[model samples]
Target: MDKQLLERVTQPLGHPSTSSSTTTGDTPGVNEPRRDYETGTGPSPQQRDAINQIFALLRYNYHNQFTKAFPDLEAVKTGKRLWLNLLAEYPADVLLKAAERAVKECTWLPNVHEIIVRCDLASSLGVPDSWNAYLEACRAPTPKREQRWSHPIVYLAGKASDWFFLANNIEEVAYPVYERNYAILLRRLLAGEALDLPMEKGLPDHVEHPLPRQEQQQRLRDLIADFDHPGRS
Candidate 1:
């Protein structure tokens, strides 16, 4: 987020010739900046410099500390390459924060892998706000009787699916509950069944029932019998 660093990375390359002097088979213009195949845009000079800056900062601040911690510590000759690889894998902010955290926590110089691990840990600390909001919305009351499904769970599942689509954080929010129940919920949605998700302490629990109480009891007994008898009907 550093303005100077951002400018350095994003500075535009010189324009290539708009002239038609060259023939169709001629080589590409030199002034035309090389495009990143993945992004289709020219790479920024600042991004390149930032990669070196990060490595330099780490070396300057922690080289001695690292040497003191490990007397046999070898010179990090490939630190720049390693750091550049890290930059490719992570955003600048994430790498910077990871480096800062490593510096604070490590007694010796930390390796690029260690900093990356720290970044992963930091990333896993919480779900995004959008996911949290979606979860919260799942807890909201269903619409009025005439306008909505009779079953709150069915309504919730529909809403949750819609929320997941909009959230862009399905991997974080969809887990043991959502992943497990998605198919069953989809069935209920398609069948127009009145879904009664078991509630615990006023919050939704995972038990889903598309059938009435008698049917559920019968199903439970049948399941128990099946378990007891193995392959028997």
Candidate 2:
């Protein structure tokens, strides 16, 4: 990740008192995270301005470079700044940890577990764009202050691989997403199939996001127990 990108990743986690007025559900966007970053919790006015500017830059970059549906950092908390240093500081671990937090404390939402497991797999497999594309399209969940659950984000770690994450209500319609996309990318790369994601964006090969396979469900539960609710273990 670029130094600038990581710099703009985090923000002080807050609730309805000072959050975006646009969101409705648990879908992820710019909101204060619930982490225990002392530095992130509160900051001086000068520091706040610097953080906000970074967020603005990130939002602009994310919208312009990625799809239009993607929300920028500004959409998080409107008044407070975040601790994005954590992103560059501990990118993958932080995300996984956040998921864990939601799992343990959050009143169960199967969809939440689904996104976490997907991200875990994507991180393990290294595929972020797949998740990004889907998130850019998925409707933002409602009940704003609730725990953030981004199905598209979980697997953003796997941008370099040949997988694109996708979601459908039925299981029977899953594998084809992964298989077809992988095949197309491979064919295109072998002999220019019209579109080939540039190498600069990591690697090119978009498979579908990990389906809610038995392993995913099981592992996600485990992630919640282990990372978020340690007491449960």
Candidate 3:
């Protein structure tokens, strides 16, 4: 392997590291700056690092295949750049997960499309994608146990992850938890485990009604009078 070539290809184009370490004297959690990847605008430093690591692993694991695929070192560099562009939209963790999948599943040097498809957690698995599942989890009507879920996995994940937390937190904080839970349940389902969603309880056989408007108003006045004079008849 040409270490020089690897260094050149993996180096960040121009952006400085956006790591928390770069922030001096700033309180750890109070007002930390948001990195590019947090808002999903572009590839973050972490994404860059993760992809670079993926390339390193691929080069090591598929040296002969990589040499055959790329005619020269320059071709290898071009291929890496192309991959960076193609995968820049994904989060760092997603990229790493996809690369891990490719390493395990592909018999040869996997193509960019293979990695991208792996990154797509929902479409590849035939389940509702994590993003849509997240929306469903967040926006489902209250009494969530009874709402019609897109998939049983979605409901199970949301319930396991805490419906209240999923509903209240921002996507950055909440989606990952939901996504992880969803993935775990998905794995179990794929392994033939049956996930039972909570059964919606039936309405009672009998129920009470509130008093009519006139009677309710009369009752309210009587209560007020009683409060004003406790012994009044």
Candidate 4:
């Protein structure tokens, strides 16, 4: 990496050594200037340093003509602040990978948003490619009794019930309504009524329940009927 670019990137954040140093005085020390990274109960010193290094590398590469467009020092500082805010949610390695990808693919110097978009894409690449693969991956390694209810369908059903209750403002009779709707949805899901078109090509195209609208309506009707006749099956 070019030394000039490193200096430029580090100068705004007061350089890593100065930022991390314990010594304090009139001179520029770690404690002298409060940075966006240092404010508001942020990452540990090590994490802060790692994020700085990532910014330095990105800025260095951009200034070195790896990207056709380069951001000025102030723009880089502002962008770094935005990136640091995301560190709590996204892993540093993932963000680094995102930065690397942006640098490789984009002709212009990528902003924080562009890097974040790449991070989402990179993170999604780890997901199982097909629904079957996803189900297999979701299976618990240890066969615990509680793990039986940990299936994806159960989770989705719970979400669906919560959504329905909220959407319909069913506060007074939340429990029975939620239970009925959840069971109905779960039944449909188990009966192969929740599948979608295979997202990836070459996978089986004729999976049952290419769309779930019909099943959803049927289950909804069952829920409504249960509500209408509270004591009836």
Which candidate number would show the highest TM-score if scored against the true structure?
Answer: 3
Predicted candidate 1 versus true structure: per-residue lDDT over 61-137, tens digit per residue: 76556334323212232344345545553434445556777778877677767877866753463212122323444
Q: lDDT tens digits, residues 36-131, model 2?
A: 222223222223333344334444444443223223444444322324332222223323343444345544332323434533543453333322
Clashes of 2: 36
> Per-residue lDDT for 58 in model 2?
41
Clashes of each: 4, 36, 0, 0
lDDT per residue for candidate 4 within 1-233, as digits (tens), equals: 45675466455343334343332222333242322331223333333544677666665666654223334555455555556666544544455566677778888666767877866763353321112222332343433223433344433443455544434553324433443444454334434465222233476767775558988899989999999999895
Q: Model 1, poorest ten-residue lDDT window?
A: 18-27
When sorted by lDDT, best at the front, the candidate numbers are: 3, 4, 1, 2
Task: State candidate 1's TM-score.
Answer: 0.32
lDDT (Cα, 0-100) at 82 in candidate 1: 44
Segments in model 4 whose C-alpha atoms lie over 4 Å from true places: 1-8, 11-41, 44-47, 64-78, 122-233
Clashes of 4: 0
- Each prediction's Cα lDDT score? 0.46, 0.36, 0.69, 0.48
The TM-scores, one per candidate, come to 0.32, 0.17, 0.52, 0.36
TM-score of 2: 0.17
When summed lDDT is taken over every stretch of 10 residues in candidate 2, the lowest stretch is: 35-44
**lDDT over C-alpha atoms for residue 168 of model 3:** 78
